[model samples]
Target: MQRVAIVGPGGAGKSTFAQALGERTDLPVVHLDRFFWRPGWVETPRDEWRQRQSELFAGDRWIADGNYGGTFDDRFALADTVIIVARPRLACVVSAVGRSARFHGKAVQAAGCPERFQMVFYRWIWNYDRDSRPRLDIALARHDHLDVVELSTRMSMTHFLESISVR
Candidate 1:
């Protein structure tokens, strides 16, 4: 795929998958977290965030990984393929917790944005299927022409990766 959009809830391995996919396809990887957060967990202004997303999506080839609902439409419109990493809530929670522990007080995905565990984030992960999936579904519906790959398990993700015939 030329323009790939990797999306899912926090700790769903979107960044990891996007990195792997980018390596396999020789495409540049764009971590939206890097652009969305300013510093110290501060958020970028909505207008500026959207503008930045547009510029990122304007690229010819790239693997963007994030779940910024506000700019989903713009990214999806430009993406030729969408990869949804849909792991179980328990797995996501565990992954997120472990990541936070490993990267606490240090930036991981975004510069100047130290990782930290939050109950609210965990709650969002736990309720992603019920609360967020519906919105994702609607968004996906809007772009039926695009190839959408949903990896519901680790094995499935591996299988999908292995199936890609990268040059």
Candidate 2:
């Protein structure tokens, strides 16, 4: 997959998977969340976000991680493969909690990090309800041209990674 997009609910390990895939394939990896979020967790304007995405996809090979509905069409058009990380809601919540702790502990100053009065773990877990998954489902359906690989369980994700031929 020359251009792969990793999609799924927040805290689903999409960023980690994208990083791993980028290492394995020796391709550039782009975290969509980083692009969408400005300093202090403020969202970048839609037009600006789209313009940045356009620049990233202009390259031939990249592994993009995160689901920004605003740029779905632009991203899908450039992606040859779509890897959906469909972990259970509970698992997603747990992961988010852990990630929030680790990220904050490290003091990784980034636009996406939750700032004053916003607890990352608490916010992320409660943010996505059942409606979010259906949105992702719709995105997959709409992008029929993409080779969709859905990993609904942790075991499946490991298996899928093992099956990929590391060039």
Candidate 3:
């Protein structure tokens, strides 16, 4: 599919999945986390963020991975397919902790935002499904015309990608 939008809670591997999908489909990949977070964990201004998102989504083919709550409509409007990586909470928590340990204080993107542990972030992950899913679902419901794929485990993501490779 062209113009894929990948979304999920932190540690859900949305970036990884976007890369894999981009490689398989020969689409450009955009990791929103890189642009959204400025150096030292600062956030890009809302107006700038939306403008950047618009430019990124204007592409003919792309795999953008991130959930910038306010820009769902922008991405969904241009995307032909939407994928949600909903791995289990425990798995997500463990993965996030490991990621922070590995990249702690190291700039992982052009924005120079280093990974760090924040109780607030963990809390968001812990309650993502119960708290954020409703909003996400509502957003998705607005784009019923787009193809939606729900992946809840690593195996499921793998299988989905493999299915694509086979095509």
Query: In TM-score terms, which candidate is top?
Result: 1
lDDT of 2: 0.76
Deviation from native of the Cα of residue 27 in model 2, angstroms: 1.8
Which pairs, if any, clash in model 2? none
Task: Please write out the lDDT profile of model 3 over residues 1-167, one tens digit for every residue.
Answer: 88899998888999888888888878889999888887778888988998999987887888898977778888898899999999999888888889989988887754577778888998999999998888889889999889999999999999998899532
Q: What is the lDDT of residue 140 in candidate 2?
A: 68
**Local error of candidate 3 at residue 165 (angstroms):** 3.6
Which candidate do you rate higher for TM-score, 1 or 3? 1
Q: Pick out the ten consecutive residues of candidate 1 with the lowest summed lDDT.
A: 67-76
**RMSD to the hidden true structure, all candidates:** 0.9, 2.5, 1.4
lDDT of 2 by residue, 1-167 (tens): 99998987766878878887887778899887667776667777888889999997899999988878666778888899989888877888777767766665342434545622345545654565565656666766887899988888878877777777786
**What TM-score number comes out for model 1?**
0.96
- Per-residue lDDT tens digits for candidate 1, residues 2-51, read 99999899999999888888877889999999999888878999999989
User: Which whole-number lDDT from 0 to 100 does residue 100 have in model 3?
Assistant: 89
Error (Å) of candidate 3 at residue 34 is 1.0
Per-model TM-score versus the true fold = 0.96, 0.86, 0.95
